[model samples]
Target chain A: MTVNELIEKCGFNAVSLPEPEREINGCYIGDLLSWVMGRAEADNVWITIMSNINIIAVATLADVCCIILAEGVTVDDEIVKLAGEKGVNILLSDKKTYETAVAVYEAI
Target chain B: MSESLTFHYDVDGEDFTSAGQASVQVKKNLRRLGIAPDIIRQVSIAMYEGEINMVIHAGGGEADVIVSEDKIDIILADHGPGIADIELAMQEGYSTAPDSVRSLGFGAGMGLPNMKRYMDEMTIDSTVGVGTTIKMTVYLNR
Candidate 1:
């Protein structure tokens, strides 16, 4: 399913939807940026609690379809702006990381 | 054969938030040069890891990317305290980064290993109290 479809089905708040139509092929759950960088496949929806700027670089480098900031972890306006500028899709979920993964699993 | 292209950037150690800027820029340059997506990903990831290591442990460094017809070379050099044990450092899950870096979602001790995992060849030259230099190459035909 595309990121837009997943967002609607999972009830996620769109933070940056530059590539809302980007397809989601899989899901990866991790908080360690380096580990996520190496393991997360392209087009995967990365679920994490980390909201630093490095997350933006990781998402871009990994070519992830979108990032779901789980556990209600919110980023500042600067991060959202960077995500938009870099063409990285981001969604915010009130659920925890596992729940976010399950939601993505069911939606995709 | 045509001449190789090189890109250079100085990593700013003061800002952890901007660690991977060079890798991001390198990714864009490779994309513009029509490098394959997979190759670009490898180069970007390897360089990104190295860049992060520089900022976290070495107080920043210099990074260079040399792109040629058959391969790409990435070199990272830093003047911070060098790794006393290269073997230990190469081992996965062995890192000397402080708690502050770990809290930022890094310092899982996978930087060098990840760099090796992505590059075709990796080498390190480090001296304690002096500096460290890492050179990695990724072949295009691979």
Candidate 2:
């Protein structure tokens, strides 16, 4: 499924949808940036509570289709702008990380 | 190779927010050079981990990417209290990073292992009081 389609179905708040049409092939849930960097596959929907700017770099490097900030985690304006500029999709989810992953799994 | 390109950056240790800037730029540079996606990912992810290690442990460092016809070479040098035990440091779950860095989503003790996982060759030259320099090479053909 595409990012926009998943967002529509899951009711995820779109913080940065620079590549809304990007495909979501799978889901990866992790907070450790280094571990996620290696384990998360390209185009996977990454679910995390990491709100720092480094998350943007990790998303870009891992080439994930989008990042789902779980557990009501919210990033500042600077991060949203950076995600948009770097072409990394950012979505906000009120669910926990596991629930967010399950939601993505069901949607895609 | 006779022809090559080199990119250098000074990693700032003071700000954790800017830790991965060098790797991010390296990714962009590799993309512009038309490097393969998988190869670029390998190089960038490896270098990004190195950058984070430099900041969290060494307070900053120098990173250089030398791109050639056959391989991409990354050199990360830091002037901080070096690793005393290379063997222990390479372990997946061993980390010396402070709690502050751990809260930032790093300090998971997977940095060096992750670097080695992506790169074709890795060498660590560290002295406890002096410094540490890591050289990693990723073959283009791989």
Candidate 3:
């Protein structure tokens, strides 16, 4: 499913979107950026509590389909701006990372 | 054949927020050079991991990426405290990064192993009190 479809159905707080229509092909749950970079498949929906700006770099380098910041993590203003500029989609969720991952799995 | 090009970046260790900037720029440069997606992915991933390791452990470092016809060479150099145990550090689940780093979505003990996994060849030169230097290569044609 596309990013917007997940946001609409899953009820996430849509934060920033460079491409809402980008398709998610898989799901990976991890907090370590390097591990995610190595294991997360391209076009996968990355669910994490990390709201830092570096996450944007990981998302772009790893070709992640989108990022779901879970558990009410607040995002930095710079992160939001960079995400928009990088054309990376970031979704905010109050749910735990696992719960959000499950919702993403069921959505697709 | 295209001439080899080298890009240099100074990784800032004091700011965790800016750790991966070098790798991101390298990715963009490679894209402009028309490097293949898969090859770029390999080089960037390995280089990114190395960059993170330098920031987390070495307090910042220097990264140079040399793009050539058959391969891309990444040389990461840092003057921080060196790794005492290369084999142990290379283990997938061993890490010395503080818990705070874990909260930032890193230091899960996967940095070095991940770098090794993505590169075609990896070599580590580390001394206990001096520092560490890692050289890794990703072959374009491989």
Candidate 4:
């Protein structure tokens, strides 16, 4: 699914979008960076509650399609800028992490 | 190419946030070299897990990546309390990391297993109270 579709389905707001056409290969929902690092596939959508710049770095390295910030978490502006520069999409939601994951899982 | 390309990185033990930087760079470098996407992802993910393990468990370490025509090899060396049981450590969900590390989204005990999973060959050498050295190789050819 496209990022926009995911946002609409999950009731999330697109905080930042590098492009509307980045393909979503799959979905990986995890807050553990190490676990996600090992399991996340390139072009996969990563859903998590963490809001650190390292997320951006990981997304860049893994070539993930986008990151959805669950649990209504906020990120540093630099992170948004970095995501834009790296061409990774970032979305935000007010739902709890588990709820967001369930929604995303169901949508996927 | 006759000459092998080598890259070395010194991982910081205390910074969980900054971990995996080297692996990211290596991934970019491999991509630039036109390596296969599958091979690149395997190498990058394996190295990234190792890097996080070094910072979380070993307090820091050194990583060396040697890129050759046929394969990519990664050597991770750290001077920390060595693993008492290599077999036990290899099990999934076994971790020695503190609660703080877990709160930061690590210490899942999947690092070594994932590394071994993606690499074609892997060797682990450790001495109690001494250190640990892991060598992993991923072949370029399918």
Candidate 5:
């Protein structure tokens, strides 16, 4: 399923969707920015508890289709603004990382 | 002909949130240079890991990315405390970063390993308490 479908069906909130319809070909769960950068395949839906501004750069650099922040972590205003500015899809989920990863996998 | 170009940036150590900015800019510059997407990805990922390491461990550093027809050269130099054990640090699950850094979703001992993973060639020059210099090359023609 597309990112938008994941948002719609999986109950994920699209906090800043620059690419709602982006195709998520895989799912990678990692909090280490560098680890994700090195391992996560392009167009993967990256799930993490990290809600820092650096995430935007990682998502953009890794070419991840979307960033799903699990555990309802909320970043500051500047980070959210930067997310929109960078044109990256940022989603929020109340579920834990494992649940979110499974949901994303099953959704797509 | 497009001659080789070089871009430099001073990574700020105080701001962990902005650690990857240099890598992001390098990625964009490489994209405009008409490099293949895969090549750009490798270069950016390796450099991004280097930039993060500079901030989290070395209190920031200087990054120079030289783009040429044959390769992309990334030189990261810092004056902060250097690696005490290169072989140990290169291990995939060994990290020296503080617990505070770990809370930020990094410091999982993957920085150096990731850098090497994404680059075609990598070398480390470091001295304890003096500084560290890492040079990585991604060959475009390889």
Candidate 6:
């Protein structure tokens, strides 16, 4: 699946720019930056409530396919712009973290 | 086996966001060396956990990675308050990190265990008031 497919399947409202085609593996659900830094794999969907730029750093380091900002959290515009620069797909969801994770899994 | 490459990093304790930079670099180095993705993940995760512990528990630390044909060895040394009880600290779900650290998505007490889990061999040396040093190795052929 792709990031666009995930957003469509979950019926998540796109609060930011849409994503281009990217590969999707599985989903990793966690907010612990260090844990996700180690646990998240390349081309995986990283689900978290963290909206910090460090989250973007981790996503870049882990090479995640897309980041799902769960719970409708708002973030600085710079993050989304940086994601575009880094070729990482960024999406936002109004659903809770767990529900978003489940939706991702079901979509996969 | 003799190491083909060595990388050393001085981890800054003040920057929570930069904690895993060393691990990220190491992962890239290993990937350029044509190491398998699984092996690179193991090395990166083990080293990243160590890096986080250094920033969270200790003020900061030093990390050294030696890469060779047979294995990769990571040494993380910190001058922060040492572990009081190794046994208890090793137990899952036991954490002493402050609330702030948890808010960053850590302090779940899984850092140490996850490091140990991903590495083939790990050793911890610490003195209560002195400091702590962790040495972890991931075998290339494993």
> What DockQ does each prediction reach against the true complex?
0.87, 0.88, 0.77, 0.61, 0.78, 0.45
lDDT of 3 by residue, A1-108 (tens): 898998999999878988999988989987778778889988999988777778988998898989898888878788899899988898889988888888888999
Better of 1 and 6 by lDDT: 1
Consecutive 10-residue window with the lowest summed lDDT within model 2 chain B: B15-24
Q: Is candidate 3 or candidate 4 better by TM-score?
A: 3
TM-score for all predictions?
Answer: 0.98, 0.97, 0.93, 0.89, 0.94, 0.86
CAPRI category for model 3? medium
Task: Name the lDDT value of residue B94 in candidate 1.
Answer: 95
Between which residue pairs do clashes occur in model 5?
A1-A108
Over A1-108, each residue of candidate 2 has an lDDT whose tens digit, in order, gives: 899999999999998999999998888889999999979999899999999999999999999999999999999999999999999999999998888888888888
Worst-scoring 10-residue span by lDDT in model 3 chain A? A29-38
* Candidates' chain A TM-scores: 0.98, 0.98, 0.96, 0.88, 0.96, 0.89
| DockQ leaderboard ranking | 2, 1, 5, 3, 4, 6
lDDT of 2 by residue, B87-132 (tens): 9999997999999989999999999999999999999999998999
Candidate with more favorable, higher DockQ: 4 or 6: 4
- Which candidate achieves the best DockQ against the true structure? 2
Q: Write the per-residue lDDT of candidate 4 for residues B17-122, one digit (tens) a residue.
A: 7787898889889889899988888888889888888887789999999999898999999998988999999998999989987776778888899899889999
Answer with 3 or 6, whichever has the higher lDDT.
Answer: 3
Model 1 stretches astray by more than 4 angstroms: none
Q: Candidate 5 — which residues are off by over 4 angstroms?
A: none
Is candidate 4 or 6 superior in lDDT?
4
Interface RMSD of 5: 1.2
Please give the clash total of every predicted structure, in order.
0, 0, 0, 0, 1, 1
Better-scoring candidate (lDDT), 2 or 4: 2
Each candidate: what lDDT? 0.93, 0.93, 0.88, 0.85, 0.88, 0.81
**In what order do the candidates fall by TM-score, top score first?**
1, 2, 5, 3, 4, 6
Off by over 4 Å in 3: none
